[model samples]
Target: MASSSFHAPTLVSILVLLLGNSRAQLTPDFYEDSCPDLLNIVQAQVEIAVQNEKRMGASLLRLFFHDCFVNGCDGSILLDDTPTLIGEKNAAPNANSVRGFEVIDVIKAAVEEACPGVVSCADILAITAKDSVVQLGGPDWEVKLGRRDAMTASQAAANSSIPPPTSNLDQLISKYAAQGLSAQDMVALSGAHTIGQARCTTFRNHIYQETNIDSFFANTRKPNCPGTPGQGDNNLAPLDIQTPTLFDNSYFVNLVAMKGLLHSDQELFNGGSTDAIVQNYSQNPDAFIQDFITAMIKMGDINPLTGSDGEIRTNCRLVN
Candidate 1:
């Protein structure tokens, strides 16, 4: 028998070609035969979780976004830190902010029992996000599946890639554009804020120092998010004051009224390129829904590891 091994350069070239060909191989019906009930199982679990705590829906949605934005929806964000890996959970953008990991664990367990290793954690995150939005009264979209779990996580990538609450309009646009998202996508996706709450520390600067915010709204939020550090830092406030638990156009409405809880939220409506897009969404709920669905589907298509490129992890937090 001949022992076979390629030179370093030849191996690198082969890997790159494989990865390049693996992109965009996902489809809506990827699991039709392998795991026919995958969507239903995920939906049922997400529904129960959201019913127990409405905030769980928002947390899941944010988790999906954070996961997708960094390293392209490959379940890298779900990995727990190991001796060699620095997981994204403890990164500056995600530390003490992202939640709903246990819900994902529950769903993963149910999925494994039903179909063993057929489904991918990346697909689970995407589908759970869509189901969560629907359960919370938001629009529904068909999620493209077939993504595979990442073998590693990157804390440095998460810290730099995930947009902060303090981003300006240009910074936000550039950040989204880097992920192949448009300004319209940015505005439409920001509507996810309608259902979630932001921590006091996340929005403290906006409530205390920003001039674009409504004085009354700022004053109201000020008490909950004291100017002093470490006081009320973890206190929660609705991103959309009108309907915090409901997924509606109230987030755009809040933006129109200068009541967006975070500086980045308000930046969309602050006399910038995204202003008209925000106004359109604020007034037309149908338009917002359509655009949001389009944007979400596009977002979910980000750099997925398809074909034989990556594995379907039996445990989302640990690669198999």
Candidate 2:
């Protein structure tokens, strides 16, 4: 969907936040009493989606990352453009990309029926990310819950906060650091790339102009990803060349081989501080999986809106 005009935050939104900034701690069983079926409902829907399309697991996981990075995991990424608020779906990094909203909508419907106003869209995203990873043969962690949906979304934040495919090592480290993630956490979390695909537009320059990439790998990618701007822009290329549908340590192995599909993916091991971490993960799948789980849970803790801060949207697409 095309983005509507951007909207600046209203004065009221600023004041309301200043008045109530105390956050409640998120817990693993936040919905045990109110929504006993919440986890099952989300897991079932996510499993179905991934079963239908293996790539969907990556998309759902990407959605959660995109949401959390911009505005701190408040479900602001799920908001739709209205007469007022500007949604993040059409932001620069997300426009024509960052999908799986329809899947999220379906999950929300099932959850609403089972628990009504108890669960939040923000919490749904956390669980969906975990379930999606599990469906794709990745390690699973107990997703902490009780996040509330944002009343407004920042398209500007979405554009700036999310690290682009072209990001370099330093830029990547700084961006992840800004979100309270250590550089080690950044590399571990990046292992999620093992199960995703990138559009040709995202990797065109990396394959053509970059020297760190392997020659044969770059040559293999060139035919599918034309050098000309806008040509074959949306063409698909697997993030992990060996097994794009599986969530494993192969992504780190690709980095070791200098075959990372995106510039940012290669940055993890490009003679930087994160190189050792990447190397270890490439050799030790157990270490990578454990660290990845640690990073996912850490990322989920970023600036959540708990207690009475935000609302539990009945429809994830629209505020009630």
The TM-score values for the models, in the order shown, are 0.93, 0.93
- What value does the lDDT take at residue 175 in candidate 2? 93
The residue-by-residue lDDT of candidate 1 on 19-131, one tens digit each, is 87656578899899999999999999999999999999999999999999998999999999988888999999999999999999999999999999899999999999999
Lowest lDDT sum, 10 consecutive residues, model 2, at 1-10
Colliding residue pairs in candidate 1: none
Find the 10 residues in a row with the least total lDDT in model 1: 1-10
Residue 64, model 1, lDDT = 94
Candidate 2: segments with Cα more than 4 A from true spot: 1-23
